[model samples]
Target: MNARHDHSHQREFNLEDREFRFLVSFLSRETGIVLSEHKRQMVCGRLVKRLRSLGMRDFAAYCALLDSPAAGAEVEHLVNAITTNITNFFREPHHFDHLRHQVLEPRLSQSPKKPRIRIWSAGCSSGQEPYSIAMVMAEVLKPSEAWDALILATDIDTNMLKRGADGIYSAEDAAHIPENYRKRFVRRLHNDSDHVQMADELRRLIRFKRLNLHEKWPMKGKFDAIFCRNVAIYFDKPTQRALFNRYADMLHVGGMLYLGHAESLIGMNDRFEASDKTVYRRIR
Candidate 1:
C-alpha cells in the first residue's frame, strides 16, 4: 500500500524538465506569458488536477496531448489553469480616485450633449476592477442618464469572465467598497448575509468578454482611458513593448493609461509620459 501511494504521488507531482520546457514554450507561444524555471512547481501543482481528470498518469502524457491535434479543446483548459487571477474590489484605490478626479470629473463640464466615454479594464480578473470603475462612474457622472459611458471588462480566462459577468461576491470581497457606494450599489440576497450582488446600475455600465492579449484585438473604437494594472508583469520585455504600442494606438491623445503599482514604462515606450505614480497619459 505504501509503495503504491508513493508511486501515485510521484506520478502526480513530478514535472520533468523536458515537459516543463515544452509547457513554457507552448504557453509563451499561445499566451505571450513566459514561465520561468522557478514556476516549475507551481505549474506542476496547477496541472495535477488536469492530469487526473484526463486520466493522464504523468506530465509527459499531458504534454503529448497538448502537442497532438486533440489539443484544440484542451488548450483553453490549459490556459485557464496556468493563468493567475489575483484581484479584489478596489485593490488599488488610487487608480479609481484618479479616474474620478482626472478622467471622469473633467468631462462633467465639457459636454452635456451625451459625450461618449469608454474605459477598458484589460486583464480584468474576476471583475472587481471594472465594477470599481463602474461605481466611480456612477458617482462622478451624476444623473447617469446624460453620459454615453461604458466599461469594457475583458480577460483571457473564461472562468474569470463568467464570475465577472455574474457580479456576485462575498461580503469580504465587497468590504473594500466605500460605505456610501455600498449602500447604493450592493444588493443583499435574501437568506444570505455573507454574499452580495453588484447592483444592476453598475452591471448595466459594463460588458465582460474573453480577450487574449497575445492575439489580435477586435475592438474598433478608441478608448478614453485603459486600466491594465498588474497584467504586464507576466510578459517578457518584447511582449510588453508590443502590448504597450498597441495600447498607445488604441488610445486617443492625452488619454489615461493606468498600470500596476510594480509596472512602469520608463525605458519601454516613448509614446507615454508619466501623469502620476504608475499612471501614464498617451502623449502622441
Candidate 2:
C-alpha cells in the first residue's frame, strides 16, 4: 500500500484498539463483563454507531468525554448502549415452570409458615425476567391478604432498570408471551404499533433496583429462589465461584439457583448441588 494508505490504516487500527480497551475496562469495572481480545471488533462495531450518533470525532475524545463530571449520567447511557439487553417475557420458560410446579406448589402444601415467596431476578434487564416470575405467582398464588409475594428485579445498568420500571414494551416485544398472559398482564397501545405496557398489578408486584453483583447486596434475607441467568459468562472463574458462593449464602436451604443455558456452577462451589441442567440447589 502507499504511504498515505498505510498511515490511514494505522490510524484506524489505533482507534479500534483505544475503543476496545476503553469499553473492556469500563464494562469490567461497572458490570464485570470481561471482553477478550477477540471481542475487540465486536465492541468497536457496537459503539461506533453510538459514537457517530453523538457526533464524536474519534474514540480517544469519546473516552475523555466519559471521564468528565457529567460522566455519571453518560456512563449510565454508555452501559445501556453497549450491554446486550436482549430479553423477552418468559424467554426461558423452564425456570419459571420449575419455580411454579416444584418450588411454590410443594412449599404451599408442606410448609406451616404463612405463604410468602421472595424471588430475586439478579440480572433482570428491562424487567422481563422478574415480571415473568410475578405473572406466574399472580396466576398460581391467589391475590389475598393471606398470601405474600414479591419479585426483586435488579441490574447494574440503571438505564435498563428505568425501562423495566416503566414497564412499557413494543408490541413485537410482547409477541412471544402466551395469549393468557398477554391478555391478563399487558395493555396494548392503540397507536397502530405493537407496543404494550405491563398491567398495574404485575408492575406493582415487581420492585426494580440498580444492583451490581460485585458489590455488597443490601437485601437482608435469604430468598426462596434466585434467577441470575446468562450473567456469569463474562466473569472469570474466580469471580464466578465467589458469585455462586454468595448466591448460596443468599438463598434459603433447598432454594434453587437458575443459570443461563450457556452458564454453569460446575466445579465452582460445593454449597450448591446441581439439580438439573442450568439449575442448582442449596444443599447446606
Candidate 3:
C-alpha cells in the first residue's frame, strides 16, 4: 500500500517536473532564492495561481513569459507573490528586549555626547520590524528631544516597501503591539475598519527603501545594530558567508547582528562571535 501511494504521488508530480525545475533555476538565478527539491509542490502551488491570473494555461507558457523582455515587470510581481514575507511587530520579543536592556541603555549611559543610534532592518516587511524598533527607542529615549535615532527599513520587494512607507496596519497586525505603544504611536481609525496608522513622529524615524541584499549595498557608515532576521535563509552558503562579512563591515566594532531563530553564523565568518542563538557581535 505504501509503495503504491508513493508511486501515485510521483505520477502526480511528474507532470510538473520540468516546469518546476525551470522555475527553481529562474528564481535562483534572478533573485538568489533557491527552491529546494522538497519545495517543488510549493512552487507549483504558489505560482500556478499567478500563471492562471496572467492568462497563461500552463507552467511552460508562464516560463516563456518570464523569459520575454516585456515580462520584466511581471517577474517582480511573480517573485513577490511566491516569496513568503510573514512577520509581525515584536515577533521576536527577546531580541528587542536585549537591544533595549543590554545595548541601548549602556551606550546612552556611557556616552558623554548625545548618542545617535542607527539600526537597519534588512528584511523589514511591511514596517513591523522597524516600527517595533522605533517604538522601543521611543520608550528608551524621550520623544521631545531624542530625535537623532534612525531605523532604516529595507526589503527587496517594492510592493512591501510601499506598504512599509505608508505605515498603516490592520487590527490583526497591531495585536502584538503593546497597548501603550498602540495608544501613543498609532492612531486608530473609526471609519476604516479596525485599522491603525502610525503617528507621524514614529513614521518619521523610519526610512523605507527597496534594497536587494544580493547586490551592492549603497548605504555608507556603520550601523550600531543590524536586524537581518530570516532574510538569509533563501541564500546559498557562499552568499550567506559573504553577506555576513559585509554585515560585519557595515557594523561598528561591538555592534550586534540579530538573525532569525532558525539562522546561525556557524562556520560562516570569523569577524563575528556568536553571542547567542541568532545573535552575533562584531569582534574584529
- Alpha-carbon lDDT, every model: 0.94, 0.82, 0.84
Question: Which one wins on lDDT?
Answer: 1
Task: Report the alpha-carbon TM-score of model 1 versus the true structure.
Answer: 0.98
The deviation in Å at residue 263 for candidate 1 is 0.3
Worst 10 residues of 3 by lDDT: 8-17
What candidate 3 gets wrong by more than 4 Å, as runs, is 1-15
- TM-score: model 3 vs. ground truth: 0.89
- Per-residue lDDT tens digits for candidate 1, residues 61-149, read 99999999988879999999999999998887888888988889888888878899999999998999999999999988988888899
Model 3 C-alpha lDDT per residue in residues 152-220, reported as the tens digit of each score: 999888889899999999988998998888888888887897898888888878999987787789998
TM-score of each: 0.98, 0.87, 0.89
Candidate 2 residues 1-284, lDDT tens each?
69999787446435566666777887777767788998776666666666777787578877887766766676766766666787888977888788888788887787555678888998898888887888888887765345777889999788789999999988887887888988888897677576788898888788999887987899998899999988898788878988999999999999999999999777788898888779899999
Q: Using TM-score as the measure, which candidate wins? A: 1
Error of 1 at 267 (Å): 0.5
Q: Which of 1 and 2 is ahead in lDDT?
A: 1
Q: How far in Å is the alpha carbon of 244 misplaced in model 1?
A: 0.5
| Whole-model alpha-carbon lDDT for candidate 1 | 0.94
Error of 1 at 47 (Å): 0.2
